[model samples]
Target: VIDIFNNFALGICEGQQLDMDFESKTSVSREEYLRMIELKTSVLLKGALQIGAVLGGANEKDIENIGEFGRCLGLAFQLQDDLLDTYGNVDVFGKNIGGDIVAGKKTILTIETISLLGLKAEIFVELLQNKTLSRYTKVNDVIKIYDQVGVKQIAEALIEEYFKRAYDSLMKISVPDERKVVLIEIAQNLMNRQN
Candidate 1:
């Protein structure tokens, strides 16, 4: 428990630092963004699961499985959060959308869009930097570029992939099928949630 808490605390701090660093960067790779999210968000979830498994008298292998499952689920959750910030309905999403674009946050969607757009990404970056532009215009224009490159689809696909990997890890645990049912249902609900 002590070690888990320590690691979790350190991971969050490091992740936050990386996030700040990415803010000034012109371009951030998908891999780098994923790593940042994993450190910032996944580590806490992973540590909790690992600690729970240890308390439950799980073997080392089961603990590892739980960690992997939590890690993947955390990644999926963060991706979904990023998606919601841009694409979700304001009423259901419970917050103003497109905040990421306005803030110029380096989400997976933006990273992929920039990568696909190549040199043309400069135009998108300019839109983000243009202080005179209204919030509506900036967000609308960025979303247009995102839609042009099918970034939402790409993000959704990545989320599905992570969920699948998480499920695979969950299945490797030694628990009986009945014991796993609740977890499976929770995972499904998480994937389908609007907020």
Candidate 2:
């Protein structure tokens, strides 16, 4: 328990540090972004499930499976969050859209767009970094660039991949099939959510 807590705290701190470090850079690779999110977001979910399984007297294998499930789910959730921040309906999502772009956050969409656009990515980055532009205008400009590069499709595919991984992990758990149904439903709902 102590070790889990210690590692969890360390992971969160490391993730935060990486996020801060990435902010100063013009671009971050997909691998670096994934590692950061795994530490910042997924570690908390992984630690929670592992600790719960321990308290519930789960065997080692079950613990491992549940932890995998948590990690994959966390990744999928963050991907969805990135999507929602850009494309979700403001009313349904209950937040301002394109907040990520306005803040110049480096998400899968941004990273992929950067890679795909080659030299053209500079224009998009410039729009994101321009403080003089209105938030609405900046978001619209960025979205236009993303649309041209098919970033939405790419990001959706990646999100689905993570979702499938989460499901596969859940299936490996030793629990009864019925016991897993609720979790499956929850994952589906999260994936389908507009907010």
Candidate 3:
């Protein structure tokens, strides 16, 4: 348990460093972003599950399954958060939309759009880099580019992929199907969440 906690702490520190480093970077790969999130978000969730499984006296295989499930869930959750930052309703999501856009956060949407647009991405990049643009205009413009490149659909597809992997991991646990109901319900709710 102590070791799990220590590992989680170290992973979080490293992930945060990577996240900060990516901010000024001109290029960031999808894999690198995924790895950063895995360390930043997934490791904490995985540690919690692993500690719980250990306390519950689960076998090593069951612990491993739980860890995988937690890791994937964390990834999907963070992706959903990124999507909500731009697309969610302010009333429902309890925050102003387009925070990520205004801050020039390199979410999956922007990263993929950069890759897909190539030379065409210059306009999009310019919009983000412009210091004088109004917040609403910048966000709306960036969102337009995102729509043109189908970035939302791409992000949704990736989120679904992670959720599916989480489900698979949950199913592999040794517990009976009935015992997995709560976890399944929670995951389903998370997948469908709007806020």
Candidate 4:
């Protein structure tokens, strides 16, 4: 238990540090972004499931499978969160849209938008980094760039990939098929949620 908790904490800290480090850079590769999220977001879920499996007397194989499920689900969840923060309806999403844009957070959408835009990415990044721009204006400009570059579709596809991975991990577990139904439903609901 102590080991799990300690490692989880360290992983989260490392992920956050990477996030901060990425903020100053002009661009981040997709692989690097995934690694950061896996450490920062996935570790929490992985640790929780591993700890739970241990308490439940799950064998080593089951523990590994459950941890994989949790890790994949965590990635899916974070991707959805990134999508919602950019594209979701304010009323349904229960938070202001484009918060990530306002904060200049380098999400997958941002990276893709920059990569697709080439020279024009400088303008988009400027708008994001500009302290003088109103929040509404900054978010609006960034969203416009994202739309022009088809980032929403790209992000949705990536989210789907993670969802598929989560399902694959769940399938590898030795539990009866019926026992996995609730987990499947939860994953579906999470992927399909508006908020």
Per-residue error (Å), model 1, residue 159 = 0.1
Tens-place lDDT per residue, model 4, 25-66, is 888988899889999999999889889888988888988888
Which residues of candidate 3, in runs, are more than 4 Å off? none
Using all chains and alpha carbons, the TM-scores for the candidates as numbered come to 0.97, 0.95, 0.97, 0.93
* Model 4 weakest lDDT span, ten residues long: 119-128
lDDT for each residue of candidate 3 in 1-195, tens digit (9 for 90 to 100): 899889989999999999999889887889999999999999999999999999999999999999999999999999999999999999999989999888988898889999999988788788888879999989898998989999999999999999999999999999899999999999999999989
**Cα TM-score of candidate 2:** 0.95
Which residue runs of candidate 2 sit more than 4 Å off their true CA positions? none
Pairs that clash in candidate 3 = none
| Stretches of model 4 off by over 4 angstroms after superposition | none
- Which scores greater on TM-score, model 1 or model 2? 1
- Which pairs clash in the backbone of model 4? none
lDDT of 2 by residue, 1-195 (tens): 778778888999999999999999988999999899999998898888889888989889988888888888888888889989999999999999999998889998899999998988787787778999998898998998889989999889988998899899889988899988987998899889999
Evaluate residue 158 in candidate 3 and report its C-alpha lDDT on the 0 to 100 scale: 93
Question: Whole-model lDDT, candidate 3?
Answer: 0.92
Q: What's the count of clashing pairs in each model shown?
A: 0, 0, 0, 0
Rank candidates by TM-score, best first: 1, 3, 2, 4
- Give per-residue CA lDDT, model 1, range 1-195, as digits (tens): 788889988999999999999999999999999999999999999999899999999999999998999899999999999999999999999989999988889999889999999988888878878889889999999999999999999999999999999999999999898988887898899899899
